[model samples]
Target: MDKSITVACVQAAPVFMDLEGTIDKTIDLIKEAASRGAELIAFPENWLPGYPWFLWLESPAALTPLVYQNSLVLGSEQAKRIASVAKENNIWLLLGLSERDHGTLYMVQWLISNTGETVGVRRKLKPSHVELTLFGESDGSSLKTFTTELGVIGALCCWEHIQPLTRYVMYAQHEQIHIGSWPSFSLYCDITAALSPEVNIALSGSYAVEGQCFVIAPCAIVSEQIIEQLCTDKIKRNLLKAGGGYARIFGPDGSELTTPLAENEEGLLLATLDPASITFAKAIADPVGHYSRPDVTSLLFNPAANRPLSIKAASFIELIYTKQIVLPGSEEVQAN
Candidate 1:
């Protein structure tokens, strides 16, 4: 007998920078997915409290202390509220956000079980070069999975799915239901032109097919309404009018299994997962199992790549000391 699970790929045209609004939107999507018999629901990245646009919009001058004004923590009170919605709906949830951890930020996706247990978090192993201007480091500690009633669940945020080794880790853990969460559609932004409309699902499908897992991929659509509210700049408005991206899902073989929702409108598409696909696909070539040959060449664990801050603490401290003379209230002098 084959096991089946209904999954939803929700496309939300999030009103940028509005935390309360995004959370409410997510809660509504959760209800809709559940109503459609979805056992697992996935959302686009940075769904809660919204993606801070200062970096993307080049508006960082608005920074302040109390709010950190730059980054907000992932497990913050505001996000916990979204987690509650997942629990209340009684479905496994995979949501993405710019996770704030203390003063540092990481592009992250969290897997929450129906019972509201935050089982595991998969951070973007390597932030895109420009993304480093805002997001923080993702270390080994954040790579893991959570056992859920529906199946073993895991997640990855945006481009991290492009990293072969990163995708290998999830495959190693034997994840059944993989959530591929994307950011709000960023089709024409000068910075994100490379992340195309077709690439979102195409790449996501490659991951599902390659990893032998069902991928519930969700992405945002840049709608006329959200554009009207957030695109005050003429260039930004024109970019949105051009087009955003689509949210979609794939079977274990990486085949498109559902249709995308309307732009700027929020909705979910539900489909069941078949475990046999993984077994059948893996028989072709399991990247980690019968397909791999450690004897040929070993895979390097690049600690520095993922944990730069943890790796450079003393150097960072030295840099801080070098700037101390310019800081206020420090008498021109003493050495420790």
Candidate 2:
């Protein structure tokens, strides 16, 4: 068999706040993708516990505080069950869990190996503006990619896509694959005047090419179920949305090698890859490499500073459990 591996990004929407429903749906999608020959898989941002969209889409005048108050706890028992599903299916999974750590909520990417082992985990460096009211993501720890059997993989949340420095870190790591987990695209958010849809496809595709790595961008595709839930809630149910649409795969050159799916049609896009593609591309113009001349200018990266900081994450967890330090804007405490 070829050393190349097959991967897919399963695009599906959780049943807005129905943790069991979201987890079950995600597991179902995983099994489906595996049946289609995907060995490694990924899902959109917070594929479990359903991403809360109404948190945006409204002004205090247009949105009711009561509606935004209720959101799914990403770290609850229902989500762990999804981990079991990943193990049982024997597919490496990159899952986005809207974390509820202690009383504080965070958006974390949880990576599970094919055997269902918790391989890597990272928190969103920061939530969208005003989202700080609903989440706790510190700028202290934002970027890194880890080695896997297939290749080096990294994760970054939505909007961060627009941040160049953030992309540089992953690219410098020589990541072979990157997962840009995003909530569904908002039709109402900023869009280009020229062929917006095409611009979007190009934008998403460029991340892969720009980083010189294959990108599995499985953005959330909201369902009518989610629309209905929001519609019914009257509070967060302000019923306005976008994205949660397509799941796409881009080649190293930032070309769409596989076709994307339709909105509301939950499914996956699988693509076979050779890690060598990254090596080949970087040969031409490695942003930080042979093509770069320090005589003109230099990009500095402190790998040493990064190595020691990882311990801070561990220490934070320990403090939360022992000191009972209350997280701002949170009602829950991280339990050891």
The candidate maximizing TM-score is 1
Clash count for each candidate, listed in order shown = 6, 15
What is the C-alpha local distance difference test score of candidate 2?
0.71
lDDT of the candidates, in the order given: 0.71, 0.71
Q: List ranges where model 1 is wrong by over 4 Å.
A: 59-77, 189-193, 240-243, 302-336
lDDT per residue, candidate 2, 1-336, as tens digits? 126889988777676776666667777888998888888888778665766665654552234333233334445566567777877888888988776655667787888888767777787876877666677764534577888887888888776777777777777777778888867764443433321345555656888878788888887776776666555555433334434476788878877768778766777888998767777787777776677576897556543223323533557777788856778888768685
lDDT of 1 by residue, 77-176 (tens): 7768877888888888887776667677777787888888787776777776556766666777666667767777778887787788887777887888
Error of 2 at 129 (Å): 2.3
